[model samples]
Target: MALFLLICLVLTARLWSQDDPWDVASLRAIEDSATYAQQVGRADQIGFSLGQQPFIANVLIWDQEGTLLYPTSDGFTPIRYELTALRIKEIETSRASAERPFWAPFDHRATKLLTCLHEANICLIYRRAELEQELGLESDALAKVTEPDRTALLAVMSLAVVITGAALLWGLRPARPAPAAFELIADQFIARRGDLTVELTARDVAILDVLMKRDGAVVTKDDLYNVGWGRDFMPNSRALDQHMINLRQKLDPDKSRPHLIHTVRGIGYRLEV
Candidate 1:
């Protein structure tokens, strides 16, 4: 899950970096094309310089209200939308015609940019960012990653996953023969190690099973919740701790050498074999 989030953040950053050139171009486009002196209270563009710049696209500026400061030709209507932090907003792009592609409510990823025209109410909207996978990079990087590099990256990731899985499996390999005379009589819900005997409930057995399966390592609270309740862990719940305290008292009636079921501070409990 951490790895997944890291990958997502990296992907998001790369996508954001692609907008550097386009942002400058679009903002310049907005600034130069301003008909209102030094900026007024509405969204408008002054330039007729479309199809000229490589980075800039069909620029359209609008105020908080969806009124087009610069009128648009071809079937394009400004639908009311609330502007927030997300750079891209889904807007409807449809014609009044009943043709195959010119139907109603065609969703387009609109790039709504906050320009310096006003107190930041004026915004320049475009469908520029969704043009490609990685915006300004080489096309071959997206389609074909030069074979060798792609193969190497995949190989490293696979090796990492395999090593991680093996380490976890080796560490969590369950202690066999019932933790040295701490015998669990499953049918009776009773555990016995020498003179000490601990009676367990079904839930206690489930939780202990999960902990014992980890050999001697600390069993996480979340993992215990998963095995014990068959549900996600709730942070507010103290049931696991209470159960472990009771089980520990039963397991260590005399509290002899090498503590059984020792709490690892913020983590869960660990048992000595």
Candidate 2:
């Protein structure tokens, strides 16, 4: 019962953490209105082309001189005092927006971004609700989710987050045993695998050294060839392959399961010990 209550509490907390759909709808409406306003501004030269054209009919367009451009239906009613309200909303939005677009993202100062045709210094205002339809928005701004649906959503999302975090932590955790460490002493070379040691020829050690430096990453044919032979590598040279074969034979005691000096078919070789 306690676990069930705890889960319910977590679910409730998560739901609370989400932005209200109404708020999201309002922001989306504003952004869409701004985009459409920009398009309309580009269409007309005098800044007001094709009737009293504003893509979002609910929006109020204003000029730099604090004159209302669209909704000429109202004649010339300059609402400059509304600038204080718009400025306040702008400051709040800029403050609330997070760095990531996915989480709690709002627009850059709505007032600043909504302003189009700066030559005319025209700006726009979008209200939350409009009974009429829009190009890319729902008929209503309110998104109503049932209680059961919200519960299901919260459960699924919580599980997904937990799974993703676990996967990342597991991937980043330290690898076991680590890569085999190699050392050369006179004629012979030695590689240590925890408690055990594998011995090889000096030439084999030289080839292995290149692969070790790469830290389990595949070493190119050219690199292996060059390191194995003194001069520049040639496509025909099989010297590197011969040495690697000898190294692999010596390293793998079972000879069935290859764990060190892997041949990558056509490309190159990789070491795993």
Q: State residue 158's C-alpha deviation in candidate 1, in Å.
A: 36
lDDT of 2 by residue, 1-273 (tens): 323433444445445444544333333433444443454334332223212322322234444454545434333322211233444334223222312111111122121122122222223433212212333446443322212225454343221122232233234333444344444343457765544567766667778788877654557788876777645546554766776666776665655442666664445776644
Candidate 1: which stretches are off by over 4 Å?
1-180, 232-237
- Give lDDT per model, in order: 0.41, 0.41
Score every model by TM-score: 0.33, 0.32
Which residue pairs does candidate 1 place in steric collision? 33-46, 33-47
Clashes of each: 2, 0
Mark the regions of model 2 whose C-alpha exceeds 4 Å error after superposition. 1-188, 194-196, 232-237, 256-258
Error of 1 at 6 (Å): 31
Q: Which digits, one per residue and each the tens of the lDDT, describe model 1 over residues 1-273?
A: 323433443344344333334323323323433422233322222232322221232333444464444323323322222222222222111111111111011111122121222222233332233222224433222221111223333232211122232233234333333333566676788888776777889987887776677654557677788888776556545787787878878787776623456564444565545
TM-score, predicted candidate 1 vs. hidden true structure: 0.33
